[model samples]
Target: IALNAWQDTPLYNDKERAALALCEKLTLSQNIDDDFYLVLAELFDQPSLVTLTVAINAINSWNRMVKMFKPTVEFNER
Candidate 1:
């Protein structure tokens, strides 16, 4: 599935939304600071709108199944 956040959508353009979007992106993209993680954790604490939780869970599931430095064993094998 091609799951992605719709940044340009009007639903996400409100004042408080910019901070929330930044938090999600920072965590999704790279390592985050303690403060940021704290904020993210707090923001995601909500019981509604499970996008953040679902996104993290999906990425982690893919990460566990991902291969690393395999010398082309699956594709270019001899």
Candidate 2:
């Protein structure tokens, strides 16, 4: 079930599917018009939607920074 959600398969409910679609769409295209807001409005409140958008953008920015910086990662086995 969790794997299906991660893979954006159709094993989830409408709201979850919609949210995943929005994230994928935004991440790939970096565009969201009024139609997307209308669909998202059905699932999340205005404030929550705003927060979601901000959070996604922040994550995208962070990922870009990480890629640009090419930070060294060291993992110590426990």
Candidate 3:
């Protein structure tokens, strides 16, 4: 139940919320609020935060490139 309804459940911790908030900003808004940085600072160091942000940006960029290319996906359904 917790896994299924973490957003509404008490199982959702601050760290998880912080991560989700960060991802939401990157994916949806493309601009982060000052509060988001404060939360991130609580969870990660300066270097780690920079690395994580860059990594996420890189992954999003790669996803955009792949989507633009529209390559065929071959999946084996077992």
Residue range 2-72, candidate 2, lDDT tens digits: 75456556577877776777778777975778897788899999888888878877887889999999999
Model 1 Cα lDDT, one tens digit per residue, 1-78 = 212554645555343463556546645775667786566566555543356556656765665566443343357768
Clashing pairs in 3: none
Count clashes in each candidate, considering only residues at least 3 apart in sequence or on different chains: 0, 0, 0
Ranking by TM-score: 2, 3, 1
Q: Higher-TM-score candidate among 1 and 3? A: 3
Q: For model 1, how many clashes?
A: 0
The TM-score obtained by model 2 is 0.71
Return the number of clashes found in candidate 3. Answer: 0
lDDT of each: 0.54, 0.79, 0.77
Estimate the lDDT of model 1.
0.54
lDDT of 3 at 29: 51
Whichever of 1 and 2 has more TM-score, that candidate is 2
Better of 2 and 3 by lDDT: 2
Instruction: Name model 3 segments beyond 4 Å from true.
Output: 1-6, 9-12, 73-78
lDDT of 2 at 53: 78
Error of 3 at 38 (Å): 1.0
